[model samples]
Target: MNPLPQNMENALTGSQSSHASLRDVHSINPTQLMARIESYEGREKKGISDVRRTFCLFVTFDLLFVTLLWIIELNVNGGIENTLEKEVVQYDYYSSYFDIFLLAVFRFKVLILAYAVCRLRHWWAIALTTAVTSAFLLAKVILSKLFSQGAFGYVLPIISFILAWIETWFLDFKVLPQEAEEENRLLIVQDASERAALIPGGLSDGQFYSPPESEAV
Candidate 1:
């Protein structure tokens, strides 16, 4: 075949260079990969907000039930008055103290839940709160068994435990992952901007590239 014209050869060379540059631009950069992962994680978390809210409601109900139980116990057994009674004692101290302590713990857990609700972006708070609530529920179940309590008393704790467990799972697998991904995306953008700033004549318009300037005649 005849040799290509000089302009055609130059055009072919420029096209190949342009194609290579495009490939470089389109290649999977680590930062872009992380951004994509974050997007997926955020999507996953979006579907679980309702589940988290349901768990929060369950926890609220459990707190109310425990409070009512505490009041009833105190009324029936003369809370502090029956401290020395064998049937009234649950832990090492007075049953009244136990009731108070349990109430305080439940209230703290409720506060955590409220914080989580007000600041849903804070996955750590939700995770910590759910973990503590689950622990309390487990303890309640064990104590009930030790004391030979009726099935009715076991019901609330069991349900609360299951809900807490589910909440924790959502926090770990969905909420937390999404939060981490968002942080990663922010970091990547910040890094890109910073890098762009350092480049000579670079235009930091949310990207890491320098704009082309017109050649002088």
Candidate 2:
């Protein structure tokens, strides 16, 4: 083959130099990587504001409801008397104490849920609070059935459990989309950076450039 023309040889040499420069810039600096991570976290923080507010409201309402139940339990008679098959069944001192303890535990759990809401805990933390509340509600329901208690005793806890789950679902719904969007945005940025690294003169002054419109087509 004939030797390349002088201009063509110079052009090829410049392109090689540019390619090497681009490669050097393509490896993201620690500062830039930290900035991107912080940006992603900021996006996540902004996206969850509504969810946090909603969860706070839910926890507050739940706290109020539990407080009301606790107050009512405190005022009620020491024991419950139920009639079954014309026979009266009575719950004694130990039974009343057990019921009181159960209510106290439920109230404490509600307080914990409120604290988690205030702290803006992770989804798993919220889920765990909800799970604990649900388990307590289920236990109450089982105890009510075993004691042949009225459905009135079952209503509040069941309602609270259902509402807790609904709130959790709303929180997940609000947060998951934002998380996915952030991930996708980061991926696009990373892919663009990689592509820019492969192009001659793409990284000049430590900045990557997209192809021109005409060149892209």
Candidate 3:
């Protein structure tokens, strides 16, 4: 063919250069992609390393809270010797404000247990722990109404409830095992992008190029 126009030749050369680059990217190894995912997960876990320490601190405070309640119960109600005198000063755990506090404590325990389970990659453990914690708290409430009139007896469940929830929220972003699977499914999108970049038209979907595979996918 006769010599093409200067601009058309330049455009064709540029297109060829771009196509070569895209092909280079599309030849990526799947193993490398998986390795990148593992690297990211390791870094993410490091960021949450202090979750256990936080749980311990909350548990310590929870214990102190229970002890304080016991002391208050003993002093306010005649040392548990006189039942009639004890009734007069016992702060009713069932009263609206106290009831709300109990619920809050319970929710906190749920949070703690959930996070702990997420860290362990055991969702069933989380569910079982939550059920046991709830059941224990419910039993305490029932026993308090039936057998004891004072608030001291109710403190353990409240403390347990608080501990569980504190555990849950500690690592809210810590992905459970199932969530990791779901997340891996999205990783295919990254591979597709890389393949598109080295193709003749780049990404025909009008998508932008993915960075080097070494970069976080």
Which candidate number maximizes lDDT? 2
Worst 10 residues of 2 by lDDT: 79-88
lDDT of 2 at 33: 51
The candidates, ranked best first by TM-score, are 2, 1, 3
For the record, the alpha-carbon RMSD of candidate 1 to the native fold, in angstroms, is 10.7
Best-fitting candidate, scored by TM-score: 2
The digit string of per-residue lDDT tens for model 1 on 66-98 reads 556555544455453563254335454211225
Runs in model 1 with CA error above 4 Å? 1-151, 198-217
Error of 3 at 158 (Å): 4.3
Please, what is the TM-score per model?
0.41, 0.43, 0.38
Report the error of model 3 at residue 7, Å.
Answer: 17
Residue runs of model 2 more than 4 Å from their true location after superposition: 1-48, 69-122, 145-151, 179-217
Error of 1 at 127 (Å): 8.4
C-alpha RMSD values across all candidates: 10.7, 10.1, 12.2
Candidate 1's displacement at residue 201, Å, is 5.8
Residues 1-217, candidate 3: write the lDDT tens digits: 3344555656666776786665556555555766766765664666443444465466446545754564565556556445323443555544212432344455446545555444555445445655666775676566446236455555545666666555454434444433565457557645554555455542442343433222222
- Measured with C-alpha atoms, the lDDT of residue 88 in candidate 2 is 21
